[model samples]
Target chain A: MEQKTAIEAFAALAQETRLGVFRLLVQAGPDGLTAGDIAAHIGVPASTLSHHLGILERAGLLRSWRVQRQIYYATDYEGTRRLLAFLMEDCCRGLPELCGTALSDLVACCPKPTVDA
Target chain B: MEQKTAIEAFAALAQETRLGVFRLLVQAGPDGLTAGDIAAHIGVPASTLSHHLGILERAGLLRSWRVQRQIYYATDYEGTRRLLAFLMEDCCRGLPELCGTALSDLVACCPKPTVDA
Candidate 1:
């Protein structure tokens, strides 16, 4: 990710509401979740959720598709991966060993949790 | 890694000068680079570099200490790792295989480069 897009993606994830929404979507995995479902799960009003979704979409952290009347939201996996790589590119310098334990724990703890719509 | 700190860190990295300074620090590794050296490498004026450094420091992306008359700045490896983990917590969902190549490449390409002060 270039600096501009990295900044945008990070900014999108910077907010509390948006961060929760993105985390939920991440946990939802590739199957994704519907707009209504996300709003319900997050306990935010649909109107407010709509605004947060717009920010995430513009930042390229999310992708959406419509199935019938419902809009499904999924984490932009590639975009997120790029952002993560950018952040970790120089992590612990050349001492990967220093960061190894933490890295593995993160990967283990955050395994994709599929959510059915 | 909370919402507030993440926002501040991301905002600090959002700008061109600040980002450049950060990348320089990342490349410089744990041994770090002097403030003057960073300014010279990034081609930003001392006064301007000071401001940018201040932002990175305030955001916790950087740490600094004085060695004689020079102040050395280095990437906060722990802070950076947290940020990266946060971004990648759900990357490629359950398909770590999908992101493995890119992640490894990032690790290889950005190995820490030490600068002698």
Candidate 2:
């Protein structure tokens, strides 16, 4: 991602409501949630939530699709991956001993759910 | 990390200069760089860089220490971990099948430098 794009993504996540919306959609998974459900879950006004959603979409952190009269929103996995890649680009700049484990541990803390369990 | 702290960190990183500084320091590794060096590398006036550095430091994304009269800055590994953890908290929220690989693929993209190499 370019610096401008990265800045926009960071700005999108910098706000409380937008961050909440992103995380909510992330937890909602591929199926996503309708605008009404998101507003209800976040206890925000529909109009206000709509504004936040637009910002997130523009920043590439979210993808929204219209289903019937309602709109569904989900995390944009590819956009997210791009942002993460930009952050870790040339991480530690060759000092593997210092950051190899540190970066890995970021995701390690939240274990991926097992299929059998 | 609390929503407030996460917001602060994201906000700190949202700007062009601040983000550049953080990424530069990350590349610099644990030994960090002096404030003068950061200013010179980023091509910003020392006073302006100082302000940006303060915001980043307060947001917990960077740490600074005094080495003689020069203050050195480096990425704060703990704060970074907390932010990443917060982002991935309850990821997919039980829908492992959808996000199991997606989240892991984040750090996986940047191959850690091998010790023997």
Instruction: Mark the regions of model 2 whose C-alpha exceeds 4 Å error after superposition.
Output: A107-117, B107-117
- How high a TM-score does candidate 2 get? 0.88
Q: Is the docking of candidate 2 incorrect, acceptable, medium or high quality?
A: acceptable
Give the winner by lDDT.
2
lDDT string for model 1 (B1-117, tens) is 566776777778877788778877765657789999998898988999999999899888899999999999987766765665554454444454543443333322112221111
Kindly list the per-residue Cα lDDT of model 2 for residues A1-117, writing each as its tens digit: 698999999999999999998878876777899999999999999999999999999999899899999999998877887776666566666546766566555533122311210
Write candidate 2's Cα lDDT for B81-117 as tens digits. Answer: 6786676566666545666465555633122211210
lDDT of 1 by residue, A16-41 (tens): 78888987886566678999999999
TM-score of chain B of each: 0.76, 0.87
